[model samples]
Target: MDIYVLVGIVIFLALAFDFINGFHDTANAIATSVSTRALSPRVAIIVASIMNFVGAMLFTGVAKTIGGKVADPAKLEHGVEIVIASLLSAILWNLVTWWFGIPSSSSHALIGSLAGAVVSAEGFGGINYSGFTDIIKGLIFSPLIAFTIGFIVMWLFKQIFAKSSPHQINKGFRTGQIITAAFQSFTHGTNDAQKAMGIITFALVAANLQSTLDVPWWVKVAAASSMALGTSIGGWKIIKTMGTKIFKIEPINGFAADITSASVILTATLTKLPVSTTHVITSAILGVGSAKRFSAVKWGLAGRIVISWIITIPVTAIIAALIYRVIALFM
Candidate 1:
């Protein structure tokens, strides 16, 4: 393949992953709204997609952090092979999770695949300890933070309106759900689209195609456009799992969960940490459910989700390793 054509193909694959990221995780931002009838499923997805696009345009720091600060691109001497392996691994995992109707993290899958391919390509020396450490910390802390916030918010709402009528409370929270869901969608764009942008920018650098660490405008446009398009398509299968399987979502609980997830995600973005919105929201929902009653949380389903989370990185990494080896033959 021509060098230019190879680059284009890599870029397109990255964008495809971004689109899948948006669609696959649409449940994180809008599932509760759709379930509570606060927004029809179609309308909710449209609104979420718009906010996701806007969020992507507003946050560029994440792309910089991943592309430049993470594993160095120069180490990826086999740039095309690296890109192909990473994206194929992530896409495969995304499809697997989606088919199972489990909400796993696309962000984590991408990172895991990238790490695996980089390690395979150049051995341990190619890895960036600093970047790896930050992501590890995020993987642990983001969900905990979201869970705490979710618990506190739900508890506070209950305490404050101890005597309020159920109907009145539900009405107020239904309105609140719109705002919080939008926040989640915005934060989703800010954090997630950057993963795709980072991959594309890193590819450019590795291929000696770009001059600086700065990602080109075209990269951002492509990443954001693909993610938004994916969000518009929505993920109804996972939506059922998130909106109803873990817990029966009421307006109040949904509002609290969305608020908690959104706040944690946006804060992580500002710090340039790429945490999974799926993990955060899922944890938040669990926290809210636990607050109602320990049994209300459906530990079985939660366990399944956690198992998926644990497997996502390693499973995708293994797949990425295989992909790298396969592509090496072509290269």
Candidate 2:
């Protein structure tokens, strides 16, 4: 097969994975706003879709990280095969989680797949320990940071509005929720789509389709567009989980959690860390739920989600490794 043709296939698959990531995680950004009747389902998805595209244009720091820093590309004997395996692993995992109405991290799936492919291609020597360790720091800290900030912001809002009339507080927070939700969606685009863009660009280079690290303008447009279109489809089942399962989200709590998730994700993106928007926002929601009372959170269900998070990386990694091995045997 021609190298350019092979690279093109990998890029398309990567964009497809990005599309799944956006649609699968749509519930993360708009669930509360929809549940609280701040926006109708149609309006919420349309608004989120626009913000998602705009957000994709905001930065490329994380894209650079994924394309250039995580693993040494030279070590992979079959770069195109690795690309296919990694993207397929992410896509399959995203579908599985979506089917079960659980919000898992697409970001972690890609990282794990790439790492697994690198190891399979050429032992641990292919891994960039410093870059890999930095990503690990982000994976561990992002959700914890988002949870703390969400809790504090929600608590403060409750304290300040304690004396306000319910009508006034509700109106104020309804307006605030729109702004925070938009911010979260924007952050989502900036971080999530870039991961796909990076992988596609990396594949091009690996297949000798591109001579440099720079991503083609067409790749950016396609990646961003796929994510935006996917967001428009929405994820209703997971929306129910986030909006109602965690706790009864008032407008004030919704606003706080959105702001907190936005802040953490934006900061992580600037630092070029491939962090999970799903993990960050879900952690914030759980924190808000726990703030009211421990019992307010469905601990059993939350525990299950945590277990899913724990398994995502290894499961996807093994899947990707198997994919590469199979492809090598046939191709």
Candidate 3:
């Protein structure tokens, strides 16, 4: 295929990945609020969609990191093809996980896939080790940070509100959950949606269509719009898993989890690092659930979720590597 045509396909695939990410991961933002009856599913999806678009428009630092950190697009002869393979692998993993209602990390899938594709095209020496390790560190520690903060936050809430009547507390916190959910959705936009933008920017640079990793305005708009539309659809199965299955989340618990995870996500965005909203949010829920009652948390399910997180990188890496090899055959 011509370089121009391949670049076009890469852009299309990048946007498609963003769209899937919207629904696949947006559930984490609104699940707690919906579960606690703080917001109807319809209202939650609408709010998430609008906030995601707004959030996506306000950041470009992380997009730049993704474009150049793993490998220099300017140096790779097969950079565009690598992007195509990475995107396809990521998208396939996303769909499969969403179908099973698993709350896996989209960030890890994209990062791992991109790295694997780079290695396929340019060998292990191709990776920017320092940059790649930093991204990995960000991903690995974010959930742990969220868990610790969530535990502390929820514990504080419990102490502060202990004397209050349960009914009144639930009533007030239900309203509070609405704001936290919106904030969560907004932070999600700031981070998760930008992965697609970065991939598209990477393609542009690789194709020599642009000179720098700065995201183009049209690229930002297209990625934002694609994600917002996907957010509107909502991921019902994952919502169920995140909301009702994790634990019986009351309004107070939901509020704590939402606010904690949102702050963590926004912090990562400001630092120009990509973190998995899925892992952060889910870990927050687990931490909050632990604080609520250690015995109450379904440890079995939490263990299963942790397993998925651990495997996402290696699984997506192998998939993308194989994809690049197959694509290489024709070129």
Best by lDDT: 3
Candidate 1 matches the true fold with a TM-score of: 0.98
- The C-alpha stretches of model 2 lying farther than 4 A from their native spots are none
For candidate 1, lDDT tens digit of each residue in 13-113? 99899989989999889999888988889889988999999999888888877776658887667866787789999998998888889999998899889
TM-score of each: 0.98, 0.97, 0.99
Clashes of each: 0, 0, 0
Better of 1 and 3 by TM-score: 3
Query: Relative to the unseen true structure, what is the C-alpha lDDT of residue 113 in candidate 1, on a scale of 0 to 100?
Result: 93
> Which has the greatest TM-score?
3
Question: Where does candidate 1 clash, by residue pair?
Answer: none
Error of 3 at 145 (Å): 0.4
Q: Over the stretch 7-66, how does candidate 2's per-residue lDDT look in tens digits?
A: 878978988998888899888989888888888889889888999999887777788788
lDDT, model 3, position 211: 93
Deviation (Å) of 190 in candidate 1: 0.6
lDDT tens string, model 3, 58-173? 99988998999999999999999999999999999999999999999999999999999999899999999999999999999999999999999999999999999999999999
RMSD of each: 1.0, 1.3, 0.5
TM-score-based ranking? 3, 1, 2
- Compute the lDDT of residue 196 as modeled in candidate 1: 91
Scored by lDDT, model 2 comes in at: 0.85
